[model samples]
Target: MEDTGIKIQPTMYGIFFEDINFAADGGLYAEMIKNRSFEFTLPKTGWLEPNSDRHSYNKESGILSIIKYSEEGANHNFARVEVNNDEGYVLINEGFRGMGVKEGAQYDFSVKAAKRSGDIQKIKLQVIDSLDNVLGATSITPDSDSWKTYESSFGVTKTEMKAKVKITFEGEGEIGLDMISLFPQDTWKGRKKGLRKDLVQLLDDMNPGFLRFPGGCIVEGRTLAGRYQWKKTVGDIENRESLINRWNTEFAHRPTPDYYQSFGIGFFEYFQLSEDMGAEPLPILGCGIACQFNTGELVPMDELDPYVQDALDLIEFANGDTSTAWGQVRAAMGHPESFNMKYIGIGNEQWGPAYIERYKVFEKAIKAKYPEIIIVSGSGPFPEGDYFEYGWEQLKQMNAEIVDEHYYKPPVWFREHADRYDSYDRNGPKVFAGEYAAQTMAIASPKNKNNWNAALSEAAFMTGLERNADVVYLSSYAPLMAHAEGWQWTPDMIWFNNLESFGTPNYQVQKMYATNSGTDLLKITEDGEKIIGKDGLYASAVKDVNTNELIIKVVNTLEIAQKLSISTEGSNSQQGNVGVLTMAMDNLEAENSFEQPMKISPKEGSATINEGRLEVEIPAQAFSIYKIKG
Candidate 1:
């Protein structure tokens, strides 16, 4: 290992979270009731009244109508039900593709209700299976004429994956309901209405360096009016307002019209989560421009104050003292201490002159107000050509701190571009390899799979990223997760369903890199040159001062085993037994599934060093990490 004296940034290996697929409302947020507030474009998108035909509102047990409290305000709509007969007047919620409940687990149920007319005494909430068998049941009695929240909990007797919540009203009468919510009692940290336990545990296990949230193209919506606004995603969950998810129609292959952002897990939760996981909070915001791939809508240059102001307010919200306005808002939500956010991104994959113009305004405003806060700019979507060149040149001239770059290419591209950043300007704006993934098929194609080929290639490419840790401050895999049954994009790092989740081979690669991310960068070369896919081998080395150990990552992408002898340079300390963690697969198409999550998981082994040199045989298509203590 050649000592380079370069310090690796602590924020190097991070996770990029975009609410694509059924990630949030369905997958992560732990909210089992869909369209809880009745605010979707179609108010009853996830609700069904089997006995009553909506076309004629014909005679049935009950007829439900959506009522708007006001033309304005976040929580505008609620369900008003008129019950004719109490026998079968039932309302069922099809949770994000059905809820997953476990036996012996307590499920919490809550709703805001008020009796509008005759004797509606009790509300019964039941967790029922596909055959309509009740798995768990709870009831709440509403004793108030005014809107008040009623809550109850019950333990399920049977574990069911495709469970649906059934609501029945006792005694025929008129009633109003809003914010009908259900969550597993056993959530992450045991907080009520918190994130999914299993899903979050997977993320925490990685020890990610940072969490980039609430986004992808969602930050820049299809139109300016629909762009993600941080202010709307905080405070009371009841008032957090839902917006139609941009991924609802982003891909034609996977049309999810019911997808929307409930914001149950909003900005405050993001900061809290980052704090919980010891990851830096990296929030990327819109720059008054819509998604260029869509409408490319722009908010008039003169009216970009609100956009610029959002950036400044976000900094205050994250770092300001309790006495400040935005900080006070944050404190009201239960956190008084600052979140200590250090990075703010201006835009997401935006490009051209319009993005630069808006970014300039945000940069100027942010630096003037909070100079210590690092601003992360964008260089459009393309990794090369005129757009990249122009954006880089402009940001470099403006002295932009970090520029986020995204790439979703084939496995071959990943192997070929292992040294993509080797020649980056030493004096220019630093890079945030913000979003990247090895696509097994075409980019954004529905046919892609998270197989060993893609992951192996990514491991090979990441060597360059680690080697150039000085210029690349942060790196994270894009579209971090996907719902196996409801994904718009393909080849995600992690995939999940209603009942279970499994890390793909790509996820294993990321975990290996992130968990062993060292403190100091060291050069690992062959014949006086960096190993960028030499003999189907790629490697990088680093020293972890905190652990008092040297870590070397090597990837072998061949059909047969290869032997490597790595020698320590300029050190007389004799090496002892070297620990090894290896993840290998002979088949490129091999992948991990819910049935076998550890199909490609790391296996621990050992090697020995002779005369300050460590010799190891790396299996074909394997990613290995060798650790030697000084």
Candidate 2:
């Protein structure tokens, strides 16, 4: 295989993050308590006051009462417990499908409390199982007249996936509590407040180009008021108000009413995660357009000022200095040095002239203030459609920096469209294949599987994505994660339950590409022709300047093995060991499971490549990469 001589951009492959399927509150954000703030519409949704019905305020030992703060704020609710009698009164929090606790691991427990009256001397926080068996226990003595924070740590003696945090008090009269929280002491990098170590580790392994924060339809909420507000997501964790996730209602196949964004993993955390992963930060802001799939609500043009301003303020928040207001907030957040964010996306999967109108305002405001900052525009939901074309045309006319395109289609569509970007204009807005997936079944179907068939097709298509690296600047797989039992969407790149997470076969493909992405893109052709599924083969070549090696990727989407005989046009080099990574499966439906995460993962092989041209065998339904020193 020979190098094609094109340069693979550093921002070639990335990842898209959204809170759908409990990705944030349940999956990434380590806050174990659900409805922690009592702010949900159904304030007691995750709370089990079985003691409620058993005991009334008139005759019971204790009862819980809801307290509301000023409606103008994000943290607007707290629970006030009137403990007439301290014994036998219990408040239980059923974590997201029960908190995942590990034996021997220490968990930090904290709560905000104000002694309204009575001598509520001690508050016991215990990680208890379904039958009330304690796995871990810690007690805090709240001493205060005004609201005060109480903290403690408990070492788990036992592990329980469905453990609840049981709260019991001693010598109590009445007390106020808000932001009751429990976090595993062992978070990613041991940060006091951080992301799930396992999940972040998977992303870290990918070496992603950029981390796109707080998004998908979450950016464009079902309604403007429900949209993700970056301002609310920043600041003190306790004050980072909660909101009904845009996905809290009904999805095409699932309804998870309990879903909400804790903002534990907010804009600041996202930037930090990007910094930690050595990836760029790309934040997408709402353009005042609600999800087109839902209400399709559009903020009136006159009322669009705030939305545009949010984009402007975000740029400052990310890159400005303490001299500026928003930038000062970033400094206070502990990252005084700018995140150096170079790109901001205006909308998510939006279309029509309304989008164009709103986009222009944001684009102008952003460019005028920070012309060096690049803005990512949208080409709507589908890869091919009237609105997609319209978006491209309009953005091209505007000389937009980059255009985001999303596609959720069948596996066949991906393989057939390997040449999708080859015909793109050389001088038009560069492409951002922002969100995409090769669905095993129909798009977004619960039955869809992240099988080898779908993954291999994406690999086949990715050949073209790499082949046209000059036109495609950024790309990523969509809806990055899903919590198994609570998911509303299927076919996520990674899936996790309360206990563990595993990358799907698709994730392996993404990881392989990102980790081995060469510095220079090159054409790998057979008989002077591009190999885009010709003879069931799709291939792309590149030269890794740092490693001084030739990297060739070949995908065989056929039923049987095919032999490849190749020769380099201008290369004459000695035989070198070819490091081969092949991800193959005879059964198209094969997938990776938590029990056997690497069952369908890539397998490494050593091949000796002779001086000039190379010959290799491509497996059926497999994606292979060959790296040979030049």
Candidate 3:
């Protein structure tokens, strides 16, 4: 191994989080109650009155009506529920494909309610299985005439994956309800309204370097009106208006019309999440252009000021002092300190002359104000095309600091293109392989699987990314997590059902690289040339200055085991045994399910260094990392 004198950036291996595949509402965000604010297009989409007779309205046991606010606002609708004959008048909230609850786990439930008419004494909430067995129960009395917030907590008797919240009214009267929500008390950091513990734990375990947020096509919605607005995603949760997710109707085969962005886990939460993971917050903003794949709508050049202003305000919110307008808003939200954000992406996968025009406006405004913030520009959606060529050429001329590139190609493409960035201009803008995945099938195909073949190939390709760490400043896989049943996209990094979640083979590969990503680059070569799938092996080497350790990553793509000796050049005799982490699968079709999450995970082994040379036998179809400590 020869020292390359190239420093690997701290923001090298990071995360790309988009709300597709119910990742936010149903997966990461721990809120169990869906349609919490009754703001969805179909306000009662997740609610059902099992016993009420629709034809008999108020004549039955009870009836529910969606009342819109006279003065239009974000919290536009409230449920006016009237109880006639209080005989099992139950309102059931079918959670995001049913709530996942563990036995003996406490869940906090809250709701805003007002006694509209007669004596609606109290509201009883219970967690019940599909068979109507109540596992947990809590109640709150509604004694106020004006809006009042009630909170209660209860513990479930048994672990249930498909438990639904059954709400019942006591006494015969009417009440207005809004923002009815439920969350597990054992959330990440025990925050009342917080993220899922297990899911966040998985992300934290990776020790990611940076977090790219609210993104992919989400920044540019299907139409200009639906694009993600950082302003709308901040402030009070009640006022953060919900929007139909751009992925809601993108795919016809796996339609997710119910998908929507509640913005509960908004921009502020994204920054907090980055802080929690010790990751640099990289928030991508809208550039006054809708997704080119859809409408390709553009905000007239003269009218692009609002979009540019959002980017400027966001920087202030993230790093400005409390005296500033946006900074004060961030402080009032419980975080007085700045998030210390350093990177901002102007657009997401947008291209053409129109994209360049809008990006120019944003660039000018942002550089004029927050000149220190490094701006990330896009190079279209695909890696190669007329639009991609034009976008790269124009961006190169503009002297952009960083340019984002995306590609979702077949597994073979990944293995063959290990030198994808070898020819990149050393003086040009740094590259961010923002969105990439090895597709076993076609891109976004429902048939795609997160199999060993794809993961192994990606591992082979990542060596190239690390090899060119000087130019490739940042890299992350797309569509991070997915709800097994509620997902529109396939082959996601992590898959979770209502009650359980498991990292895919792809996730295992990412974790391996991220956890061992060293500080400085080193050359691991054969005959003084870099190894790029020579004799079925691909490798990269790095040294962690902090740990005083050398990390060598090798991937064997062949169907047979390979033997090799790595000689540490110009080094004193090592004192400790080499730590070996092997993740191998002879079956390329192998995958990880909830039942076998660690099926494809790394297995710990050891090796000894003799005469400044480490001898090891690499398994077939595997990715291994050998850590040598001084």
Candidate 4:
């Protein structure tokens, strides 16, 4: 029997916003220790103190104490040296006890000391490099006992240095020091500008259709109170919202190590960013009020109304007009016209029965007022029955517009099961691969070089998604950007910093798919003997309606090169030129760093057609798109 021709349909290639949140959190501490030094008063209590001067650290005490006072400049003082955890370390002018410094550098520091009698003393500061050489020194005199700050600058070589303050005893009297700070001549500060120009151009170049904002886990934390609060994030950069990050494993601190977050770049910023990028905004609202930090708990429905209302108000603000109250407020805020948001997601990865019930509530309320809008519900794994399946079942019963499917698995699994939705019921709700990433431990680790297997697997999966595009509407890669220093997850689509960014090999594959893939499914078949595997060479072909062009996407999964013979049996024009775009790299883990970004970029070549058949060799561990004019 003759084989059946393959079909292709419209598919979405996009990115999840979670990885951007990663950059906001552990990636870059985000406005925490700006310019290196900050000043604060030491509380009398709620601070911990160490017994020895060698070990000065904070545990959890209520007060700060300055101990170890020496008269006439004694090198050591035992009982007089007091310490407090909240107030941080104190400066005792005894022989200039100092803190560790960066290597190959010099620094100058000074402090103002206040005594119990309300008297003040100006103290000189000095720094020593790693070689114990005195690099810089400066003096400061306080006007009053009331808290004062002294300033000075010193130079250090391109090596490590330490900072210390010394009291030159002109007259014999002990001085008390509090609220002292030191500044390095140079510090590795974070990116001052919002987004890099090159990155902005790259984002613009992609011409993404839509943008998913905020985050995955960043939306909600272990508790209902900890969830992302959109209201707190809007307006005024200085007064923007903040929260503790929960994604990075490195944040495993003891005794509730407080990692405060500043929500400077919040919902308003996202809206503005989307507008600037010329992409539609798809915001995810929290469905489950209760959150799980180390453990899970449920929030009462009555108490959850506020959060629900917040979501409603947000939608209104985005889509409403000046005629309405919130809409007017939104206009005053910036955008007078409606943001025209047609899609809004309920919760993220809420895979429980309770979530289904909660989603139903959102669906009913949202649809009641805005029936034209598309409500996307989270659907779990395949074959149905999991929380996602249950959610979809509920959505189907309630008549949902779209259902989201998330998958993160081994590349090999994706390659083998690329046609996951091949037999899916199309009459049911539309499908969106809301979050999918092909990650393997071997390719993701920093220790390994670039691996093309992951990229190939993802490309093969894209081929399947493209072929099954009738049912699979939209898809995106999760954890898109991972900053090297603050990465909690691995194998991200792109890694960037203030100065530079680069797309992964897998990312390039998706980009090519998005840029070149066709919108219509074409009918094509291969000889049984020509098929390499059970599924043969992964392929999808589409004909563009406007340009009258036929695009064929093909992936050779075999280890050895495959020569493919192509022919358009149904078309009148049997012969056509073939434009090939291929992604091939020497090392699989071969990544493009900030220094060298185009190391693994795709290359283009062409092949000639003869009679009605064209033969081409496709390399293994590679992805290629063969385009033929219709």
lDDT of 3 by residue, 234-287 (tens): 899989999999998899998887889899999999999999999999999988
Relative to the unseen true structure, what is the C-alpha lDDT of residue 616 in candidate 3, on a scale of 0 to 100?
Answer: 95
Kindly report which residue pairs in candidate 3 clash with one another: none
RMSD of 1: 1.0
Task: Please tell me which model should have the higher TM-score, number 1 or number 4.
Answer: 1
Q: Report how far off residue 569 is in candidate 1 (Å).
A: 2.9
Q: RMSDs, each prediction?
A: 1.0, 1.4, 1.0, 9.7
Candidate 3 weakest lDDT stretch, 10 residues: 567-576
lDDT string, candidate 1, 1-630, tens digits: 777988999899998998998888888899999999999999999999887877774757889899999978899999999888975798999998888899999988999998999988889999999999999999999998899999998999998889999999888889999999999989999999999998999999999999999878989999988889999999999988789998898887899999999999999999999999999999999999999999999999999998888888999999999999999999999999999999999999888999899899898888888889999999988788888889999999999999999888999999999899889998889999988988887889999999999999999999989999989999998888888778999888888998899898888899999999999998888999899888999999999989888899999998999998888775443669899999999889999998999999899999998788988999998999999987
TM-score of each: 0.99, 0.98, 0.99, 0.71
The backbone clash count of each candidate, in order, is: 0, 6, 0, 42
Model 4 misplaced regions, further than 4 Å: 1-11, 19-21, 25-193, 249-260, 291-294, 381-385, 442-450, 527-536, 571-576, 586-596, 610-612
Question: What is the lDDT, from 0 to 100, of the residue 82 in candidate 1?
Answer: 87
Candidate 2 residue lDDT tens string, 1-630 = 445456788889998998888898889988899988998898988998766565444747688888997787778899998776666688999999889999999999989999999899999988988898889999999899799988898799987888999998899688999989999999999998578899999999999999897878889888888888899989888788888887766665688888877888999999999999999999999999998998999999999899888888998999999999999999998989999999999999899999999999988888888999999999999888799889988999999989999999999999999999989998888999999998877876889898988899999999999999989999999879999888987789999988899999999999999988989877677777889878899988888889888788899999999987656546544576788999999999888998888988999997787766578888888899988888
